[model samples]
Target: MKRYAKAVWHGSGKDGSGHLTTQSEALEKNNYSFTSRFTSTAGTNPEELLAAAHAGCFTMKLSFVLDEAGYYPERLETTAYISFENGAITASRLFVAGIVKGISLVDFEACVLEAKVDCPVSMALNIAITTEASLTD
Candidate 1:
């Protein structure tokens, strides 16, 4: 299957502005601009969205992996950190902390690695991806 989003931009580089929207309306007319991209301004940027996508994808993938492994999950919290430098994406770091049932630490770590590597978003991103996952009591 294929998924898509829309982005529209106008004006010049340092002072320009844009908005984004997804097919599902998850982001409707979300505003973004040069300041938002480079600094800690309001609204969203590409890196923020990329991080969200990675986090969401990894979380879902982990749920699937846990279910398939005969484990029930209460929560899987994932945070994705994407670094952009020198006009390129350097890396995407995935920090996952889960509250799962009926799984050992070793097994859960392995499953987290599998999800990190096998998730569609992780596989599609052309950047270094790393995961640090743990189970919380």
Candidate 2:
């Protein structure tokens, strides 16, 4: 299946504004701007959207990975932080917390590594990806 999103930017890059619209309109022409992207503005930006996508995709991949490894998590909370540097996105950090059982540390680490390589968003990002996970019984 193919999915898509569209970004519409108006005016110059430094003084411009834009909104992103998804095919399904779930985002519904949400606002983005240079100020929002570069500074602390109360608006949505590309980095924020990337963070959301990374977090969601990683969490789903982790869930599947854990299940395949014979561990079922009661809860999984993930955060993806995207860092923008020198006019480019340079890194992403995945922070995860969960309650799981039926797996050892080695197996869990292996599953996480697999997810890091296999998750669609992770694969799409051309940046460094790091992860931290805390699991409990």
In candidate 2 the C-alpha lDDT for residue 22 amounts to 95
* Tens digits of lDDT, candidate 1, 1-137: 76779999999977889999999998999999999999899989999999999999899999999999999999889989999999888899999998987788999999999998899999999899998988898
- Quality of model 1 by C-alpha lDDT: 0.92
TM-score of each candidate structure, all chains considered together: 0.96, 0.90
RMSD of model 2, in Å? 1.5
The clash tally of candidate 2 reads 0
Task: Give Cα-based local distance difference scores for all models.
Answer: 0.92, 0.87
lDDT of 2 by residue, 7-85 (tens): 9999999898988899989888888898898889867998899999999999999999888777787888899999988
Superposed Cα deviation of residue 58, candidate 2 (Å): 1.1
Please list the residue runs of candidate 2 whose C-alpha ends up more than 4 Å from where it truly belongs after superposition. Answer: none
RMSD of 1: 0.9
